[model samples]
Target chain A: MTCEDLDRRLSEGARAADLAAEPAVATHLARCPECARLMAWLLRGIGDVRVDSARASEIARTGLKPVRSLPPARTLIMSLAAIVAGVAGLHVVTMGADGWPLLSGSQAIVFAAFLAVTLALLAPAWLSSLRPGARQRVHPVAAVLLLAAGFPALAALLFPVRLAEGLAAEGVRCVAGGAMAAAMASGLLFLVTRRGYPLDWGRTGALLGAIGGLAAVAALQVSCPRHEAVHLALWHGLALILPVLAGFLAGRRAG
Target chain B: MASPEQDAVPPRTGAAGAREALDAELLRLMPRYQDADRAAADALVLTAGPVLARYFYSLTGDTRLVEDLVQECWLRIHRARQSYRRGEPVLPWLMAIARHTRVDQYRRWKRSSGRETGIDGLVRQPSSDPRPGIENSLQAREVVAVLHRLPDSQREVLTMMKTNDMSVEEVALATGVSQAAVKQKAFRAYQAIRKALGVSRREENER
Candidate 1:
């Protein structure tokens, strides 16, 4: 047996060794001080760690019944991405594509592409909030926050900044419609991930709100005719931001 | 920490070692537990007890905290049981929950106490010379005489490996990092252990 075998046996406690009977074990022991050091402790009979069975009961108690596991990450994430697409697309179709005719062909393509990439990038992080050990390329909160900031900046570069009459009033109408879509998206996202075991409620809640906000912004991009930068920046930005704050509060409460 | 269920997992034969057999058994128990099998759950707890306790003790070095963490870990594990997939290695799922438990507790303690406790008192261990050789005790702080020389990540990998005879895939999953990361950390840890052991052997040869 190798030194690792000896280590395993030592880890096994009692029935661990027969130094005189196994020359390989003895010779390796003679050479490796770390194993020998642990062996010395074993010889003193203080090596075994004995914990109470009451502790085991705590574990068994939790597993006492039938339950289904969550679906694969790909399934969950794809469905979330689908939620963004379905909800935004449905809203835009019903509301009319007035903004499409107004935008330069290039302007429309890049804006639509940005929204598509944002949703795609976010799908993986969406899975992270559902499982404690899931891999995260970027934190969900940070990702959502970046979209909140980045989208407004992108709109400023892509759209006109001309001050329009009744900008506040028109902005409110646009934000109201966007906020409704965000709330709907948030509700659906929550429903999809309802079974998830979020290690942090606030972060999960924020993601929930962010998804709603994203659906609204995407919906407005096509349905709302006005392409003015300030309207998009002021109203569309709030549409996503408020829900995230609300989601964080709700998540903490649920936690 | 040994339990009756320790005998309950299907016994290994041929090339399978005890740890491999145990891991296989754990993999089987997880799906059963999801299906609500009390026996499987009991077996999982009994078999995993020593490993979880060792994982915590190796990290915190406090027996009391280990007990609390184990208990808390179970509650979270039960609530999060459904989050585990049907066929994934089970230890990673379990260790991830155990880690969450530790971090949650640490946060609560920090919030309530308003003072930072260094991750453990291990960092506070006295270093006055006498340079004890490798035969020193295997208590949490003195495992290798140079374990403290390891950064926490490397030390954590070594302890987890020792805890369950965990393979790289299991450790990588448990720590939620890439397998390459686990290898690098374990490599660094073994280097430290060997250096400490080599020094002791050189002294013995000189004598």
Candidate 2:
């Protein structure tokens, strides 16, 4: 057997003696000193090197002091949701919720449905960032990309406006408006979650940025006058990308 | 890779029962510790000291730094106690913090590599067992030496599993990665060890 095969077998729990009993493995072991050493170690087993912890308990007790635990995950989750809602409410209040009224009843319903689903999806990510050792099945960047694309995709598919003169000219302003809203919401989240030590800072930052971006998109959908499909889709997509990019960079920097 | 504890065949009494008892005790003490109970905090440090030491020892294999690292970890745990929710398994939280401490120590060491004494670089820890026997034929240093060549994250995953007798799920929880990621790192680490050992052996031969 090759040296790699021997290692694989040993790692798989095959006894060294049993492997050595085979002629090919023995021959291979005869030439490969590394394999031979590995076989010898496996045959004899290893000794435990003593670790000194005599003063650890004493050191630990001396350092003990007062500490207040964080609130429940639900409370933190609500606080995050509140940040988004608060930002959206303020945007709608200040800018006016005029765009949604421009759409048909079914179109408005579809838009609201998309926003609701996006919020539901994002809540767990916020909760996971707060809790240490939280299991994230999907990588953060992938999740961010999918969620970021979702808003614009909904806009592209549902709302197709005719190309009028200066149709997409106002898109940049809308994107900026959404970005500001995102930045504000994400900033509030950072303040509230300052005490939280996210194991994956990048994930936390990306999700934080995405939450803010989505809030801006939702708020702008209602408040912004332009309901043109390309305008909404392009600006909404840019809005989503901007905050996620900021958060990602921030997360990477923090991490 | 098979855990070192599993490979060693050492006579560890009530390993599972001991683990369960420790788990229960730590869980019981965590909430109290968070409530500013000095007595509970002391109890926690004392209880988790050995386990944390073993974990750090396995990851870094520097007995000298293990104590310091453990203490630093406890300080972090105390500071981040606010993040630890009630009724959660406390070891994962403690272990998760311990990992960051180890990582931070590594980063600091890397940053100051020009000034490092290089003492911690030596993973060749002397065995406590002095008796002349089969155990003497294979040193723990050699096993750790083979492990030392792995990438940091892979090495941490493998050594923590093998030496600490931690399961994949537990390691995943401690490291804040998926269990699949843990398994993949372990499998890759195992495959890499053979190649690493071969290279190390060649270097020694040339010397």
Question: Which candidate comes out best when scored by TM-score?
Answer: 1
Task: Write candidate 2's Cα lDDT for B35-137 as tens digits.
Answer: 7677777778778776776666555655566656877876677667778877777777777888888777776776777566443463435333443321322
User: How well is each residue in B25-89 modelled by candidate 1, as lDDT tens digits?
Assistant: 88888888888877777887877777777677666655566667788888888888888877777
By summed lDDT, the worst window of 10 consecutive residues in model 2 chain A runs over A44-53
Task: Give the runs in model 1 whose Cα sits over 4 Å from its true position.
Answer: A1-48, A93-97, A137-142, B1-16, B121-141, B144-154, B178-207
State TM-scores per candidate. 0.75, 0.74
Give the per-residue lDDT digits (tens) of candidate 2, residues A93-139. Answer: 88788786788888789888877777776776676677676655455
Q: After superposition, how far is residue A116 of candidate 2 from its true place, in Å?
A: 3.1
Give the C-alpha miss distance for residue B189 in model 1, angstroms. 5.3
Q: Report the C-alpha lDDT of model 1 over A1-255, residue by residue, as the tens digit.
A: 666566444333213234524777778878876667655533332133435646667566753677778987778877888888888988887888888778899887887787777766667667877876666666676678678888989989998798888888878888888888888888899988877787778888888888888888888888888788988888888887888898889998887
